[model samples]
Target chain A: MSVELDIILSFKDKMFRLAHRITGSYEDAKDIVQESLIRLWKMADKIDKYANPEALAITITKNLSLDWIKSKNNRINKMQIEEYENVLVSKEFSPEKSIEINQLHEMILKLIDSLPAQQKIIFQLRDIEGLTNKEIAEILKVNENIVKINLSRARKKIRELLTKIYNYYEN
Target chain B: MKIEELIEKYFEAETTPEEENILKEYFTSANYDKKLEIYRQYFIFLNSERNIVPGNFLPASILNENSKSKTSFNILSYKWLAIAASFLIIFIIAFTYFKSNVNNAAIVITNENFNEFKDLGTEVTFDAFFKISEYMEYVKSSINDIQAVNETFQILQTYNLMNYQ
Candidate 1:
């Protein structure tokens, strides 16, 4: 009913997605989303006057996610190694199709992580989270053209990485 | 335009986001040309991961969490609060330093400043403040960074206060 509610309803899921993608942990993502919402909730009275409240929300979510990742770098590295060992261990134990699919999921995440910082953020904002170019530009504090170029580069690299995997799997 | 045309424009960053979405859809679709097999699963994976929202995470729940607890440790205990409070003090110090020392780059907070507060004996006395302030400068200097610095300051809230049976 209220403008704040409208803004939160519109962007909370997207904020969660942004946080989750960047942090790679659902619990931390949820915490970041919750913290971002609390911030937005504080500004609820003045939210409507902003030109694009969703951009503000996404920006907050982005900053918080970056902070969360920085704080958890050690834990994340441990998890990645654990996940790597997981896929390795399961290679022989699991059924072929499921293993391949799971490995593909992990590899995609790795590929996304491998991208240059700007390109990865752009791809996450554009393709994964589905923000418009202008919205992403606002969120990243960059020009729309920058967003476009980064997204293009990210996609090209992802395509190359996936092609290698697809080839490996097929042959 | 032909799908090939769209794909070409996409690689060049010439397509609008909406048109890119169409390319995404076409690539993931069953009818897409088999020659694009290399990119098919990739697109499909991107689409699936794009849509992967964590379940049962509702906006109302976040609001509810905020409203549920007014506990003392909830928000104030966040390190940002401490850092921010420290930053304000540093900013004031910087302001005063800039007022006095127009020639220098940094303002040193010497042991002399702590002496001024040392006489004020109370639970929130100068000693406690000194120790707590000490923990701040070492690792926190990077955090307190806003053009003010001092070679002195030590201690940050010790365990003796909570010594209980």
Candidate 2:
């Protein structure tokens, strides 16, 4: 394949992960990736007009993912928040000290999902996607400081809640 | 410096992504410190999530469409270039014709007597000189017509003399 196609394919999973994090639906994320690829393909000849094609692809995926959310008028439902809060403070410390690591991982994932949209996406880009603050800022069209601050907030919240869950088990 | 210190720095949101990657590697390794076990699952989850690729995506269709559009763009550009070249050629030919006409309009009369008239300063002299030149052209054409008629008369006289003989 051509160099442009190679570059685009290299970032396919990155775009997919970003979309999946933002929209929280595998199907919507896949659609967003498809749309992004089509757009990049159309501009393939002029792709160099973008200083960073990977960033351009991510920005398009982010915008389309947000559009999907806005069109559906959906936020993380109240039930999910209640579930998250209950998980954080539940007093059911089974003395059976052998809790599965997978369960803890699921709990952390839910806690991440419970964060505000901006903080959650910032955290996702930084931690799970392994992107730099500047890269996330460019993709989200925000200042680097804003990305850093939001990421800090996200990490603090998740760490605090996870600590609470661990404390409950300890007690 | 220590892994525990780095983990604390990470929670405080003071660690760079490179440092975080180190933490990730340490936690996901088989021999992470038992004291750091609390953060192990989170790191493993992040690693797993990062590894999650979308299923079976083939962009052959997109590449095909892209190639088609590229071909059409080249053709359109070539067509526009041809039109531009044709217009440039026409403009050059018309400009040369107009420039030659301007040069002919400014031709200087070259008679020796006219040199004396050149000292008669002011634009009026040049205007009068041009008028004189036009009149001279008319006189010259008239003389040529008279010469042609005289030749015809001579021929008629020769024929009359022959009949008399």
Candidate 3:
């Protein structure tokens, strides 16, 4: 149990980032990652056979996150990603500076959440989690070119949205 | 490379990780071109997103369950120990009870035998006393008869002398 738990904990942050990118909620991401680790723990014996356990864990988290979204949709009460951004915004902050910064972060998160799932994950993995395109492709089981294309689209869309907001504020 | 060139490369998603780092540094430093100020917030958000962790929300039940399993293992061992101790106690009690009953039975048998032997001795002594009394009476009767026979013999001698005179 110790060995398995340690192995799972090593991937905790990475798995959370992947899940968070998909689910757009810290709480949901935590649940998804926890479930992914549990599943990994169940297959601890065969996990060594996989060359990249991290990638396997990420894939598992990604699928569970998608499943979470599906189940939420089936319930007909899908939660807004902005609600989770509010949770992220409520953290300890200095009065004026922290509020503005948190709002900016929240707005950026909301914008990122608007991207399609593939583009969103690629952007998170590359720009935020700081993984190489090759690694992202490996984790996604897609080609490096696809990963690049999605990342480019994600960055362009976010930049386009930000420019609109900035110009509006300037006016 | 020029900051403008790096910014263009960044939006194009063609910047290397190092080049992106330089872009992030330039934007966050707030010394970049005024036109790039909008992108500064975006880069700042990215930098902040990197530090955002799930933070101690890894489901306490998992870790708690592990501890609970360890506790349950200890409890299982204690349960077996308690059962074994109970068995040992029962065995000792049963052995003591059997030994005491056997000793009591042996004592009762010895006492019953001693009482039977006393009753048989008393009966034999009474029979012997009765037999001795009967033998003494017979001897006395024979002595009397002998005395009578002597007197008769004297009388016969007196009668024969008178006839001769």
Candidate 4:
């Protein structure tokens, strides 16, 4: 395979995963990845010139994800006034380990969803996607300090929320 | 380290990657105190969530479909030909319009010059009438002695004579 194809295949999963985490919806994530692919393909001639194809792809994915979120939020706000109603309702917990695991997953997803937009993105990139603060800073086009601050804030918020839920379950 | 100190360090941005790994190890161990079991579950939940991959097939399918899409321009639509023809027609029309306008202006200028010359002829005739009137008043006594002066006067006064008749 050509370097271009190799690079694409190598970064495709990372791009999709990052996009998925950023958008919080599978379909939007897929669309963002496809859009990023199209962009990379269109600029194929310049691919070899960049030192880091993954960084380029990540930047493209991040920007496209941000745009997708903005548009999707607008559409959701316009069409669905009862958007958060379902999320706010608590589900009954089960004693089975599998059921508990599933419930825990849902709760974690909800907690992540409740995060502010920038913090959510920062958390997704830093924690879920396993990107370093420097890499995330490059992808987000911000200072490393900002990335650190956002990541710290996001992690702290998630920890507090998880701790509260845990205490409630324990008692 | 005390849980409070660990949590404080985590918040203060002082935790190194090694410290974070230690915390994760501490949280995930089965032998951690019962009080910390819930915290253990939370950390396990986070660790599991990190690699979950979301169970989504849409991104792969989209990429497959996108790969199949042609990046090259389609000639079958005839769009390029249509654009070229439209541009050619516009250029031709603009050229023709400007050429005709220039030609028409030249023709109008020539016509105006011809009309001016015709008006000059009328002015010359009017001047001749005035000269004849002055001659009639100044040299009325010698008017009859001039050969063909009566005929010239009669030719000049033909319109007046016809109207009177």
Best by TM-score: 2
| Candidate order, lDDT descending | 2, 3, 1, 4
Model 1 ranges off by over 4 Å: A1-3, A74-99, B58-165
Candidate 2 per-residue C-alpha lDDT over A52-102 given as tens digits, one digit per residue, 9 for 90 to 100: 898888888888887887887666522355577675455323457556777
- Give the runs in model 2 whose Cα sits over 4 Å from its true position: A75-82, A88-97, B59-165
lDDT of each: 0.71, 0.79, 0.77, 0.68
- Clash pairs, candidate 1, are B109-B150, B131-B155, B131-B156, B132-B156, B134-B154, B134-B155
lDDT of 3 by residue, B58-128 (tens): 55666776677669889999999999999999999999999889767532326668777676657766888
Summarize candidate 1's per-residue lDDT along B3-103 as a digit string, tens digits: 87887677666788789788888987778998776566666777887677666555565456445544435565776788899999999999998888786
Task: For residues B1-165, write the lDDT of model 2, one tens digit per residue.
Answer: 899899789977789878998998899899898755678877888888889999878566785765776687788899999999999999999999999897676535568657665675446678889989999999999898899989899999999999998
A1-171 per-residue lDDT for model 4 (tens digits): 245655765676777777776677777877788788778866766898988778898889888987887877733313221233333234444443232656656666666676666777777776656677788788778898998888888777667656655655555
RMSD to native, candidate 2? 14.4
Compared with the true structure, what per-residue lDDT tens digits does model 1 show for residues A22-115? 7767888898888888788878779889898988898899899888767766354334323543444455334453335556667767766655
Tens-digit lDDT track of model 4 for B101-157: 985663233665877677766887799999999888878667655646878788879
Could you give the candidate ranking by DockQ, starting with the highest?
2, 3, 1, 4
Q: What is the C-alpha RMSD of each candidate to the true structure, in Å?
A: 31.8, 14.4, 17.3, 19.6
Which candidate model has the greater TM-score, 1 or 3? 3
Please give the ranking of all candidate structures by TM-score, highest first, separated by commas. 2, 3, 1, 4
TM per candidate comes to 0.59, 0.65, 0.63, 0.57
TM-score of the second chain of model 2 compared to its true counterpart? 0.37
lDDT of 3 by residue, A1-171 (tens): 466667777888888887887776777888888888778877776877888787788788888987887877522124444454444436533344333656666667777776677888899889988888998899888999999889998898777667655654555
Clashes of 4: 0
